[model samples]
Target: MKAAVLRAVGAPLTVEEVDLSGPGPNEVLIRVVASGVCHSDLHVMEGVLPYPLPTVLGHEAAGVVEDVGPGVSALRRGAHVVVAVVPSCGRCRLCLRGRPNLCTAIRGRPGVMADGTRRLRLPGGEEVNHFTMISSFAQFAVVHEAAAVPVREDIPLERACLLGCGLLTGWGAAVNRARVAPGSSCVVLGCGGVGLGIVQGCAVRQAEPIVAVDLWPQRLEVAARLGATHTLLAGQEDVPALVRQLTGGGADYVFDAVGSPQTAALALSCLGRGGTAVLVGVGQRDASLSVPITATVLNERAVLGCDYGSAWPQRDIALLADMYAAGRLKLDELVDRTYPLEGVNEALADLKEGRALRPVILPWGDS
Candidate 1:
């Protein structure tokens, strides 16, 4: 199978015909249809997040199940599914408590079945690691059955791919983590794909006076079209002050989708008394965010981190799918452009330019 391999940090990806193994027990082999170029992948490429090099870098994806391994009963061949980055051990304490996204037992290892062996091999017979436990960048991927969520047949594979990451992260932050109530005021920092999802999520729940913030005017425009009741330029000297003014003091909930200390701090400040601030973005490894301990105590502000929108694949995927089917969640408009696998660099360039909402990579035939 041909895949875009990240051979080194700060280097261009090379296309290579790699060898992929068949599925093992509890694993599913998927024929990759489409994958989204996410910022996390770029982070890995640029060394923002440290990981093994020569790994296939893609997590947000959707495809058709070509085969399922022994003991995999929930899925069948030819079934349409979206691959999740967070592979849960189902019996873990977090998964048992209804928080599968927090399950970390399956991470930090090479891409192998639970037996600890490599699945994909290079042409020279060397083992190549998979990224995010999904590695949807390749022509085919071997993912755990728990990581593959079955989606409706009617939904386009490209749109369903977004739900695996950006959509779930944004929507889950609003509905699950922050639990923003209807008729409440909220502010979403950064109007990128995830931020836009947060905006739509807030709107779907009827969160009144949704404030969208971003430096780019185009994203602000898209955010308004999606669900933002109000848009902020994000060019002001003090964003927190602007947010407070827009919501008449402060918002009931604030979301930081950019994941930087600056944006996280701003989101924390945009919250009203007793309001909650959810940080959904992953910051740099050495980066740390500081907050006023006195101010947090005085105003009773709560700051929290949201992982994968706290999504439970089996249930949340279906929930978002139903929302998309019912027109409550907008997926088609979220796509900015599509690129062939060979044009992955162009797609990443578009992403860095802040010119794309969600750039999807159509592996082969879709292009």
Candidate 2:
């Protein structure tokens, strides 16, 4: 199978004829229809988040089941599915307690299955590493059955790919993690793909006075089109003050989707008393968030970290699919460009330009 493999850090991914393994017990082999080029994948490629070399680097994807493993009963051949990066061991404590996102089985590092073994290989007998436990860059991916959530047949594969990551991360941040109630106010920092989804989620919740802040005017414009009631372009002015002014003296919830310390501080400052600040971006490894100790205690402000929008794949994927089916989620507009696996660099270049919202990768043939 042909895949975009990262041979070295800070280097371009090369298209190579890599060897892929067939499904093992409880695993499913998927013919990847489309994969989203995510910022997290860029981070992996840039060595911001360190991973083993010669790895296939896509995580946000949707495909059809080509084959099922011996013990996998939840999925069938030709079933459409979205790949979830976080795998939940169903019998684990966290999974049993209804928090599958925090399932401890695969916590802290990249490993596959209960035995901590990888499934990918190279043509010359070398083992290839998987990224984010999904590795959807390849034409065929062998993933645990739990990681593949079955979706409806009608949803477009490219749009469904967004639901695997950006959509789930942003929508879950607003609806589930932040719990933005109706009539509440929200300030979303960064109007990129995930930020726009957050804005839409707030709108779907009937949250009033949505404020979106971004340095890019185009993104801010898209934010307004999606759901934001107000847009603030970050120029020389203070963002927190603008958020406060727009929300009538402070927002009930402020989300930092940019993930830098500066944006985190802005989100913290824009919050009203007893308000929550959600950090949705993955910050740099060495960066530290400095918060005023006195102010946090005095105002009763809560700072939260959201991982994959705090979503349970089974429940949230279905809900997002339903929302997409109902025309509530903006999956179609979120797609900026589509590229084949060979055009990975072009897709990524467009992603860094700040013009395109989200770029998807379409694998060729084999389905």
Candidate 3:
């Protein structure tokens, strides 16, 4: 099987004929159909996030099952599924407590299976690492049955792939983590794929005066198209003050999809009394946020860290798929373009250059 492998940090992914292992017990083998290249993957390539080298990088994907391993009664051959990055083990305390997004079993790191073993190999039998345990950069993948979340066959896998990560992160942030209430005011910092999802989620919850902030006017325009009541091009004016004015005093919530100390500070200033700031983006590996202590105590403001939008993948991924079918979620619009597996680096370049929003990788036979 052909796959894009990151042999070193700050290097381009090399497409090679890699060897993939069959699914073990309670696992499923999927023929990769559509996979979304996320910013998180870019972070790994740029060394913004430290990851093991020689790994296949891709997490957001939807595919069809080719075979099922032992103890995999929940899925079978020909079943369509979305691959979840966080394959929560139900027996873990976090999963049992309804917080599978923070499942402790995997320990929030990838490159290995649940049993902590590599399933990929080079030509000479050198072990290759897996990214997020759902390396969909290849033509096929072997994942735990729990990672293969079933969706209605009616929905196209190309769009459904976004629900695996970006869309799910944004949706879960607004609806689950933030618990956005109807008529509430929201300020979304960043209008990338995930930020747009947050805007749509807020819209579904009836959030009034949705203010979207982004450095790109093009993205802001798309944000407006997808339920943003107002769009602010970052650095033009006092964005914090404008957010307060648009929300009729101050925003009830501010979601910083561009994770950084700068954006965190901006979010801190865009909040009302008792408002919350949810950091949803992945910044540098050593990034740290500095919150104002006095203001936080006096104004009762909060700074919350969001991991994949605090999502329980099984439930939220399916719900997002349904929401899209119901015309409430914007999936097709979020996809800026599609690329072949060999064009993985170009896809990442487009995203980094702001030429695309959410680029999906397809099996264009260049693999």
TM-score of candidate 3 against the unseen true structure: 0.97
- lDDT (Cα) of model 2: 0.86
Q: Which regions of candidate 1 are displaced past 4 Å?
A: 108-114, 236-238
Candidate 2: where is the Cα deviation over 4 Å? 106-114, 365-367
* Tens digits of per-residue lDDT for model 2, 1-367: 8999998998999989888776877789999999998888888877888888878999998999999989899899999999987878878888888778888775325634444677777888888887776788879888878889999998898899988888889988998898899999998998887898899889999999998888888888889889898888887668788777777778899988889888888888898888899999885877778888888899888999998888899899988898899987888888877888888988877777785789889988323
- Writing each residue's lDDT as its tens digit, candidate 1 over 1-367 gives 8898988899988878999997987889999999998889888888999887678888999999999999999999999999887878889899999899999876657444455666888989888887877787878998888889999999899889999999889998999888889998999998887898899889988998999999999999999999898888887547778778878889999999998888887887788888888988886977678988997999998998898988887888888888899887898888978888888888887887898888998887574
**Segments in model 3 whose C-alpha atoms lie over 4 Å from true places:** 106-109, 364-367
Which of candidates 1 and 2 is the stronger one according to lDDT? 1
TM-score of 2: 0.96
lDDT of each: 0.86, 0.86, 0.88
Clashes of each: 0, 0, 0
Candidate 3 has its poorest 10 consecutive residues by lDDT at 104-113
Error of 3 at 114 (Å): 1.1
lDDT, residue 307, model 1: 89
